[model samples]
Target: MMGVKQFPEFRSERLLDYLSTAVMVLDDHFRLMYLNPAGEVLLATSASHARGKAIRELIINADMLTEHLSAAMENGYVINQRNCRLELPDLHSLIVNCTHTPITLPGQRNGTMLELRKVEHHLRIAQEEQLITQQEATHALLRGLAHEIKNPLGGLRGAAQLLEQEIADAALKEYTRIIIGEADRLQNLMDRMLGPNDIPNMRGTNIHTILERVRELVRVEADSGLRIHQDYDPSLPELHADPDMLVQAILNIVRNAAQALEGEGEIVLRTRVQRQFNIGNRLHRLVACIQVIDNGPGIDEQLREKIFFPMITTRSDGTGLGLSIAQSLISRHQGLIECSSKPGETVFTILMPLDSKNES
Candidate 1:
């Protein structure tokens, strides 16, 4: 039997960079010595800034985690904790599976290797898969229904035109015109229900350009009492997408936020780059996260889940196709749209994969 070959020190470090789990090495004093890329994401800090920082400084309210690390290092024992909760400096919390193993090197002091796997990440992947399947099924059913409704609508409009020509009385012709008008309206509605038909005109595009277009249009249409703000990450790379489609998708969400605010509250458009994100079953190394946040009465819990379905609306005049169409457009670009609402805050997040080569 062949023995496994040991990787060189640099090669091992390179291998750690590709791991999905967050890995960190700490000295006996619990000061950060090494941090992988995944670790940087989890801690929300860069390796250069985090190196030599105490573990306590990086993770606020980490007494429990610190205790575990201390015991592992002192006793020279490996410890595994499931669903360990850690508080971050930004006040965000994470539920992760933590593994602490003590290690010794020839010329270096004793250290502990800490591995963190986010528990919620697994759950999110499962939920995303379910959401994608549900959306596909819903879209398929709507397309079938629209096709059936459109055929009869075309015949009804044609008959109305023919009847109008045969009628002599102007009063009776008025009724035919009304019928024709309504038939045409219904035909347009059916087309909207069917969603976009053309393939996206994909090209290298900047997300900020699309967002600015949406902001300008929304600002013009919104009431004077409503305020729109932008918090953008200028470091984001150009996204490969259809600019027009992205504009339409983002516009729909922003408009909905403005409406949710009843044209009297605040709306913020924020952008960031999320690393190692999963959309449905595929994982991308980088993703563009765009958020439309509103301070409003918020969506009712019962309607939140069905908000993306056709004809489901909270407003009396709403066609409810805005969000559905928006979702479809983002989906066409291998992205996802998610919503979360509370009494005072509502957020619509659009996640678009940025690394096409890493998608799998």
Candidate 2:
């Protein structure tokens, strides 16, 4: 043992910091002794300020976690809880699989080491994959349906025009005019269902600019009662994307939010940079996250699931093509749109890769 080199304790601490799973250590009295980097990010608090705080103060419904810890401390055994809900101080809840291992100190009372691995990470990835598949399938089906409908629609409009010329009576001409008008309306609807036809002109552009353009357009359409807030990360690098398409997609989301608010609540246009983010099945080292958040009544649960599908809408006057078009546009740029809604909040997030190498 004389020549053997010992692995320093600090190296073990660093190893904890490197782990993706959140780790927290508590003393015999349940005071926080340590927090790894993942713990800080997950809890939205730094270790410097969180250390020495009572565990109950940092987590919501700490009683449930403490009950298990107390048994482990008394029995000197390890405990594992599957699918535990932990509400952080920030009010966001995460489902985690936690392990509580009681540690013994020489000639002293026992403490507990906690490891919390988020279960939502896998759940989200699976959800994204299903959503992307659904969107692609829906798009293809709609395109084929639109093409079939448009052919007869054009012929019907032409026939109506010819009939209108042949019918010298003004009364008959009015009927033909109505037919022509209806055909034109249906044609426009089918065109919208087809989504953007041109390929995206990808170029280096700032996301903030696109967001601001949408903000301004919505501000003009909406009443003064509506407020738009910008919470942007200035350090975000430019992403290679079609600014116009991004603007159109973001505008659709924002306009939908504004309409949902009924000219009242606030909408936030927020942007942030996500590191090592996944979009659909692909993973990227850097990604741009754009969020359109609104404090409205939120989308109905039944309809929220199919909000991005063609002809699915909540409003009576809505064409139902807005969100479908938006989703299609974002997909063209290799990004995906996801939504989460509750009673008081609705959020639509657009995740696009920021790395130029990821662009087509």
Candidate 3:
């Protein structure tokens, strides 16, 4: 043991211990090989205690997870995202979004290293980065489209009116009516698209109040057979938002949920605190999360990812702009909207950050 040089193992340990993020290094087996301090925080545990334990048992089923890593490892390098359902030992289920990116080291053969970062965290960061770019792009397009669209709309309406007066055929009038009606529809759409880019300053207001208003409106329109419930957190403070925009956002989601229920099912509006929430790729101090859930034939899987995009809808007569408008409004207020659907259940969640620095 004479002149035994110090290995970098201790130095590597120190590096993992101090890093702000949880970095776990797994071998080709997807085992719990090494968990840094930040990684332990993410899992609600410490590194010292999680050693040598099979990763599968610590969290929920890791079968889907192993595939993400294996695919990444087999390829040169891959970045994969997984929705991990973490069933903690306490019998509570917490869903975390995780990313598995392959890590290859020099002279390492068939390497597999997985990095798991919370989805909400990563999403917020992504949203932040994408917001300005998306806004600029959307704004430029909206402005240009509005001008281009409004001009054609006027010409169509004028031409339709002239045809109605000149053409003696009653059936010909039907064709003009269709053109005129479509022009008005396009005008309405342009209003929704370009009307609110500049508005009054946003204010701080009660979220439950907005939700209650939306619920009451829906319940008024709803039939006697339908049931609407409120499951709200009374302790949540007022959020910084535009009252009109907030109302519109809540109404769109609630209305969508109620319509899905179709007047004979249960629609629940729930409010809960997402202890540490992120939005627009930034970790907000605290967030107000409201879920509009319905028991009905759920949204189709193929349409889930595209639901927030403009002009996407499930209804035959729907404008396909409700969700898009609501999303734009919430985005202006620095909030987020997400939807999940399965058999007999669909949930639309909106997360809005609170303004108060100190707890009230």
lDDT of 2 by residue, 1-360 (tens): 432335665565567765667899888889898999788877778899999999988997888899888888999899999998998877889898989999975568689999888898878889999999999999999999999999999999999999888888998899999999999988988888888898779889988989888999999999999999999999999988888988999999999999999999999989999864678766565789999999999988889898999888768998898999999998887799999999779999999888744444
Tell me the RMSD of model 2 versus the true structure.
Answer: 7.0
lDDT for each of the candidates? 0.90, 0.87, 0.74
Alpha-carbon shift of residue 194 in model 1 (angstroms): 0.6
Task: Enumerate residue pairs that collide in model 1.
Answer: none
Candidate 3 off by > 4 Å? 1-87, 93-143, 155-182, 198-201, 356-360
TM-score of each: 0.87, 0.73, 0.63
Off by over 4 Å in 1: 1-13, 27-31, 52-54, 70-78, 107-111, 357-360
Query: What's the TM for model 2?
Result: 0.73
Q: Compared with the true structure, what per-residue lDDT tens digits does model 3 show for residues 105-150? A: 5567454556666655665567556754565576567668888888
Deviation from native of the Cα of residue 124 in model 2, angstroms? 0.8
* Residue 159 of model 1, lDDT score: 94
- Give the runs in model 2 whose Cα sits over 4 Å from its true position: 1-117
Better of 2 and 3 by lDDT: 2
* Candidate order, TM-score descending: 1, 2, 3
Total clashing residue pairs per candidate?
A: 0, 0, 7
Task: Report the Cα RMSD per candidate.
Answer: 4.5, 7.0, 10.9
Compare the candidates by TM-score and give the number of the best one.
Answer: 1
